[model samples]
Target: MSSDSRRFVSQLAHNEPVSQVFLASDKQLRPNRNGNLYLQVDLSDRSGSVNTRMWNATDNDYKAFDNGDYVHVEGATQLFQGNMQLIATRIRKARPDELDEGDFITLQSADIEKMRTRLTEILEQIQSTPLTRLAKGFLKDDAFMDKFCRAPAGMKNHHAYQGGLLEHVLSLMELVLAVAPKYPQLSQDKLLMGAFLHDAAKTDELFYDRDIGYTDAGQLLGHMVIGVSMLDEKVRQIVQQDGQPFPERLLIELKHLIISHHGEYEYGSPKLPMTLEAIVLHLLDNLDAKVASFSQLMADCPNSESNWTQYFSQIGRKLFKPEKED
Candidate 1:
């Protein structure tokens, strides 16, 4: 059945089997929680969102079930803890083709292909050899390219979802070009590679199945670490096949770009950006992510002169309607 955007939870489908169900994802996990416990779910459909919770004490969210698994939320809509959450009596895995495309994931309605065309145009303008080659190889893979283009750059924070990676990459590159000219201290080539290839590993690591699900690699190593491994492996392969000396120094510096892109070790970086490019990449990444998340907040929910939303941790601000300009 087609999930109407207007209907977040079908009062009619309350007792029926959960036909058009949106799945549970790791995106809902709160910071401090017990192992086997109930979870507050971000039940998303194109229309809007409803909070879902599994109240059954026997549930195993920390062990058996996981984030990003498709599940049938079968039960009735009931208020719990003063919130609108579906009180699920039973929950089971949802499979592919079990839902209409629109019901399962939230994506910008913009044309994905057009986004790709524009992304490729920016990529071709890159002058660094390894950066150019890396971008080309990733964009060439039919399956990977499709997922990368469509996947959110992140589950939250910044450019999140299909075309999100491309958009974020493009934004970082623009920032680098605009800023690099002023700082002769920064190697343009190194900065470009670090900026362009830093997140390329996310193309493979993150799988947007159901709702921005991580592949096994993502679950384990994360995009930054996996990307460095990917780069190292590819460099080894290139050096082995041909006796030509690969740019080892350039490659090492590029690795730093990925390692320090997260800005802090705990956040996932090996070190804060020592090189100018690394610093720039981190700052621009933060800027773009915060702006995108904030923009989404403004667009999805308006002030309406009625209500204001709680502070968004991603954007670190309360969501409010933008004032109209004459």
Candidate 2:
């Protein structure tokens, strides 16, 4: 594949001929109506993704490329069922050096440096001594900070792009600060600490240095448990440094916030949110994630002229995008 110039998936238009290389985010081999085998691949760039069809493909052709591999694709965009689809004429794996890694990885569009500063400011605003120490412990860890600043919040759910975890954390912190005043019973310290640590282990849960996927521990133990473990370790280190034990009650409560932030057991929380702070954290965390997911869906909606998006399996409803008049 020649690396002359590349067009992003977001820039594609209907019937536009394209000969570009993109990261193969996903792959599936399926049978059409006549029982003909075809390859379905999700091509992506730093911008967005598009589904492509490689018809009349054999098992060998399907085996040639795997998800997370960069592939040189020759295709023309077409409207399929009112969505943009790529009809691939040629597909083959591209060399690693053929494309820049930064070009394929989708990053949060926000100013990361500004977000980092805001993150520090929020951490500083935590009044609880133990909680601020714990937050700073994490912020000081270079390895953890690097991963936190780059890891996606999930593989596909809310904040799934690079630097998404930080964005999610900062947004939730900002939201909690805005709403906490009305609910005086809500501990600002606990809420802010919980917001920062809620998905902290997502740094370990997701492997996004290359492709966004789950780590072995992420699949087995998940982020909640991992986060509790992380908290335990950090608390131990803090106790070691300060020569005073981290308060047992505070430790227990913080861990509870992390594990129970999911709100419901079926939704992956090990325990229900029983405390006022926990309940508030659950509501705000869920609110930010759901709203971010909805925003992402709307932004990625293919039909620009349509006022509604396709059905979303997560929410079980298609979102209405009402047009604005001048």
Q: What is the C-alpha lDDT of each candidate?
A: 0.65, 0.85
TM-score for each predicted model, relative to the true structure: 0.72, 0.88
TM-score of 1: 0.72
Off by over 4 Å in 1: 1-5, 8-20, 26-40, 47-50, 54-99, 105-110, 129-144, 181-189, 239-243, 298-308, 312-320
Q: Residues 27-131, candidate 2, lDDT per residue (tens digit)?
A: 888999999999998887776678899999889879998777888898799987656899998899987667676676555445677798899998998887778
**Pairing residues by index, what is the TM-score of model 2?**
0.88
